[model samples]
Target: MCDTTPKTPIWKAIADALRSDLAEGRYTPGDKLPTEAALAERFGVNRHTVRHGISALVEEGLVRTRRGAGAFVAAIPTDYPIGQRVRFHENLIAAGRRPEKQILDVEERAATDGEAKALVINTGDPVCAYHGLSLADGQPIAVFESVFPLSRLAGMASALQDTSSVTEALRALGVNDYTRATTRLTAVRARATHALHLQVSEGDPLLRTSSVNIGEDGQAVEYGRTWFAGDRITLTLES
Candidate 1:
C-alpha cells in the first residue's frame, strides 16, 4: 500500500536544509551564504522562496543580512559571565577565543550628573572617559564606555593609551583590584553610531549593562556602560 501526506512547504524545507548544514559546521561564523539565485537553483525554488527561508534564519539569529551584501552566518552567542570578577581577557581566553579591544577614544571631561552619581563625584568634576569596541576573534561583539573620576585616577587616559586592557590600565595607577559593586541590565535598540561601530543594522537588538566597579578601599572607581550585540553575546548570571 502507498501512503500519501502533505509535502512540507518549500521555504520551510529550504530553511531546514540550511539549518542542518550550519549544525554540521559546513559554514563557519561570518561565512557568507550563497546568493539567493544560487540557492534557488540548488533547491529548485524561486529567489523569493529562498529569501523567505533565509529570513527565518535571520529571525533565529543564525544569519544576518547586509544592506548591499548578502546574508551571512551569525556568530554563535558567546557566553559571558556577570559576577564579582568580570574580566574581559580572562573570560574570552577561558572560552577559547582571542579577545581584543579597539580604543575608539579617550578624553578627560566634566562628569555629567549621571556619571557623577555613579562614581560618587561632584557634577562637573573631571572624569576620564574611555570608549572602545570589544571583539572576539576579530568580530565586533560589544561597545563599552568607562568613566573614571579623573581626580582619583589621574593617569587613566595615559594608561589606556599604552594598553587596551582596562585591568592593566587600572593596575598601573596602583589599583590592585576592583570588583563589581552594582549592575543594571536592559534591552535597547541599536543606534546608528552603535550600528556603525558594531556592524549591526540600526535598530538591531542590544543588551545594555550599566555598572559600577569599586576599588579595594570600597570607593567607586569606575562607572561603565557596555552595549552588547544581542545576537553575538549571551550575558549569564551566577547563582
Candidate 2:
C-alpha cells in the first residue's frame, strides 16, 4: 500500500501524490481526473490545495483541463532539441521514434529580401524552397521552410525529395563542407501553419529558430526557419 502521508509543502505533497497515482496506472492518459472537491477530501487538503496540485501538473504538461468539464491526463511529450545541427531523422531515432517527413512545397523561385539577406545572396537570386513538416512516430513536431541558393545548388530541389536532410543534400551537391554556421532563436506563438501541424492552440508557445548554413569559404548555402512545439521538444546547447 502506498503511503498517503503529507510531509512537504501541502501543494507539492498533493501534486506528488497525484503524480504517483497517475504513473502507477491508477488513472490512464485521457482519463478524467476526480473533481477538486473529491481530491481535496481524499488528500485531506483544502480545495485550494487540490487546485494548486492540478496547476502544477498543467504546467508540467502532464494534464489538461477543459472548462466546464474536468482535467485529464495529457499524452506524453516527445523530446526534441533545437541547439544542434542533427538531422530530424537522427534526432527522432536518438529519442526512440521513427522519423518521417511530409513535403509541403518543393520548388525553385527567386529569393525574397529576407532569404537573400539570410543566405547572403543577391536579391532575386534563384533559390530552391522546400517546405515540409518533420514528424516522429507519425506525430507532426516541426514545420520547416528552407531556401538554398539555386545558383550554388543546382538540381537541389530534385535531390531533396529523395533526401530531405539539409546536410545530406548539401553533401551530394559538392557543398558537403558546411558548418552550424549561424543561428538565431526566439520564443514565438505557433502561427498559422505550425498551429495546424502541431495541433496546439493558436498562439501556443513555440521555439522559433532561424539558421544559415555556410560553406568554408564564408558562402551561405542554405537559410531555414523552423518552429518547434515547446511541449514536444527540448533544446540543449553545450560548449
Candidate 3:
C-alpha cells in the first residue's frame, strides 16, 4: 500500500531528493538533469512543485534552467591554491574534463570607469578585453570578460587565437609570472549578453565572480568578470 499520508511538502521533498543526489555524486557537475515531468513522476509530485524545488536550487547557485534545453547540474569550480597560480584550462583538465572557449570578441578598447578602477589603471587607458564563453564538453559553463592593461600586455589582442584561455594568451605575450587572485562571488540573474552566451534562459540565476590577479611584484595584472551557469557549476574553496 502507498503510504500516502499526505507526506512532506512536495517542493521540499523534491529539493531533498536533488540535494541527496548531489551529495552522493549521483548527479555530477556539468550533468544535465531530467525534465520537470520526469522528475515529477519520479517523485510523485506535480510539475509545478518540481519547478519550485528547482528555483530553490537556482537561488543557491546549484542549478540552472535553459530556455529550451532543461535543467543541468553545475560544474565544480576549480579553486587555485591561495598562493599558487593555475590556468583555467589546466584546472579543468586536472578535473578530467576538456576545456574549450568560444570567442565572442577580442579587441583593444578604452577601459570604462569600473574596469579601469578594478584594474587600478586610469580611466580611458587602453585595455585588451577578451570576452567569450568557456565550456566543458562543448556546453557553456562560464561567460568571461578578462581585461588586462595594454602597457603590461602589448600586442596581446593580436596574438590571441580562437578558443585560447587568457592565461595562454598572456604567456604568449611574455608575461608568465603571476601570483594568485582574490575572488568575490554572489548569485545574480543572467544579463542579456550573459544569458545569450551561456545559452540559458533570460533571468536565469548565475554565479557572478569578480577576480583580481596580482603579479609576483604585487602589481595588479588582470581583472575579470565571470558569470557561471548556476546549475552547471559550483565554487569550492580549500585550505
Model 1 per-residue lDDT tens digits across residues 1-239:
87688889999999999999999999999788999999999999899999999999999989999776789899988999999889998999888888999999999999999999999999999999999999999999999999999889998999999998889999999999999999999999999999998888889899999999999999999999999999889899864
lDDT at 55, model 3:
89
Model 2 TM-score, all chains together: 0.71
Model 2 Cα lDDT, one tens digit per residue, 21-53? 998999875568999989999989899989999
In the range 42-79, model 3's lDDT, one tens digit per residue, is 98888999999998897887886677888887656543
Residue 95, model 2: Cα distance from true site in angstroms: 3.1
Question: Candidate 2, clashing residue pairs?
Answer: none
Candidate 2 local Cα displacement, residue 124, angstroms = 1.5
Angstrom error at residue 171, model 3 = 1.8
List per-prediction Cα lDDT, in the order shown: 0.94, 0.81, 0.79
Q: Tell me the TM-score of model 3.
A: 0.68
Count of residue pairs whose backbone atoms collide, per candidate: 0, 0, 8
| Distance from true location, Cα of 7 in model 3, Å | 18
Which 10 successive residues of model 1 have the least lDDT summed?
Answer: 61-70
* Clashing residue pairs found in predicted model 1: none
